[model samples]
Target: MTARALSARSLLRWLSLLALAAGCHVAPIAAQELIAHPSAEIATLTRNEARLYFTLRLKTWPNGRLAKVFVLPDNHPIHQRFTNEILGLYPYQLRRVWDRQIFSGTGQAPITVDDEQEMIQRVATTPGAIGYAAVPNEHPDLRVLQVR
Candidate 1:
């Protein structure tokens, strides 16, 4: 190949490596996708608080209500995205936490839903549930939970 072509390829490779280091590929879902029940007191959670909840470490909301967390199946893209971007965890890492919780008997795994629709339905009807969807929702009973 020409020297110019080789130089351009090198630049591209360097830029892609920089993007990986900066965690650039987590697609930003619109604010409406991460949802909770309308009655849930939480409107927003900082990253640490979200991690605590998803890891099953924080079981209750600040108001003494059990935070019933729901999630799409691990194979679902929405599940992967939410876990990676919002919770700052990979699916397997989250599963390890859940597996330990199950075998150790000191904690519990989040309820798994089959799809975004079920996630929305379950979270909307379950009173204190939290989950994610791929797209913005218009359910009257659901409220979007913001992440800081």
Candidate 2:
């Protein structure tokens, strides 16, 4: 091949490597944002507290309202992210908790939504609903619960 063609190829390879390296350096945002109906009694929760609610251990809100938990399908990446970051557990671990609850006649599984949009919609409209998704603008009908 000609020297000019070889130089162009090398330059292209360097540029592509630079682009991939830059992408790898980007700081990742939070994996999930906790959201709830605007009127939910609780505003913040520690990781363990959130874990209890999510795992079906604490079924009622502080105000005695039943806590309606919503989640995405288990295979979804967001589900995995939320399970890791917020619940401090794996999706399979949470599934096992739910399964045990159902089989033991002690509790039920959470409501499952299709996507982030549906997750937000259900939590925003249901009185005692709680769910998580990508960070979103503060909506009048929804409250973003700070994870302590």
Candidate 3:
């Protein structure tokens, strides 16, 4: 490679690295403060806890009342990620499990809702219920559970 060409490439590489570092440094400060906000104080859940909570595998709350769950549509990316991250299963696998439960007549799968507002409304009205959303809706009756 020619000397001038090599020097130009090196300068570009250094500039890219510096820009990346600056971006990395700036991004976390905003995220950290947002996460620390008072209303966002819901507890972080373990993978198992999140799974059981959402799947209704934990049929009842610690208080013994039957637990209900609400979920977003299967096609949604966030729902897919939530299922994979919490249950260690894809949406199809989770749906199959629910299908089996329906066939067995032992228990029902959690209800799936169209959007966060509907989910929040359902969970708020239903006793021992849980659901998730990007930003929680303003509902006096609903409780938002935090998952780390």
Candidate 4:
């Protein structure tokens, strides 16, 4: 091959590598901005607290208030992702797990709503309420609890 062609190819490779490295560096901040959900000042929760809140185990906050929880529809993508990735259970398996839990009558599950907006609105309107929603949809009305 000619020297000019080889030099052009090397330059292209270097540019591609630089772009990739830059992207890698910028990715985390972008992801945080995208995924991070902020809550109202009074609605803040620690990671462990958030987990307990979501599981229907903690019926009340540490402050002696009832902990109401709003959840997404069964078929929501976020619900699927959360159950599979975070809870380590698939939909069918999750059903079985819930069934077992229900049979024992340990506690009630979070109230499932149709969409993020509905969950957010319900949580906002209801006292001592918490809910799941996409970070983008999070608003001043609803508070997001951090999941440990």
Model number with the top lDDT: 2
RMSD in angstroms, all models?
A: 8.7, 11.9, 11.1, 11.6
Local accuracy by lDDT, each model: 0.80, 0.83, 0.60, 0.56
List of clashing residue pairs for candidate 3: none
TM-score of each: 0.77, 0.77, 0.61, 0.58
When summed lDDT is taken over every stretch of 10 residues in candidate 3, the lowest stretch is: 29-38
Count the clashes in each prediction.
0, 0, 0, 0
lDDT of 1 by residue, 37-127 (tens): 8667878889798889888899888887888999878888888888866776789999999999989998999998788778888998997
Query: Residue 119 in candidate 4 has what lDDT?
Result: 64
Assess candidate 4 and give its TM-score to the true structure.
0.58
**Local error of candidate 4 at residue 100 (angstroms):** 2.4
The positional error of residue 22 in candidate 3, measured at the CA in angstroms, is 13
Q: Model 4 over residues 9-119: C-alpha lDDT tens digits?
A: 578567768879788532221111111112233444554455555666667655677767666767888677665434434556545645666788876666778875676
The list of candidate 4 runs beyond 4 A from truth reads 1-47, 84-94, 135-138
lDDT of 2 by residue, 53-100 (tens): 899899888888888999999999988988876776789999999999
What pairs collide in candidate 2?
Answer: none
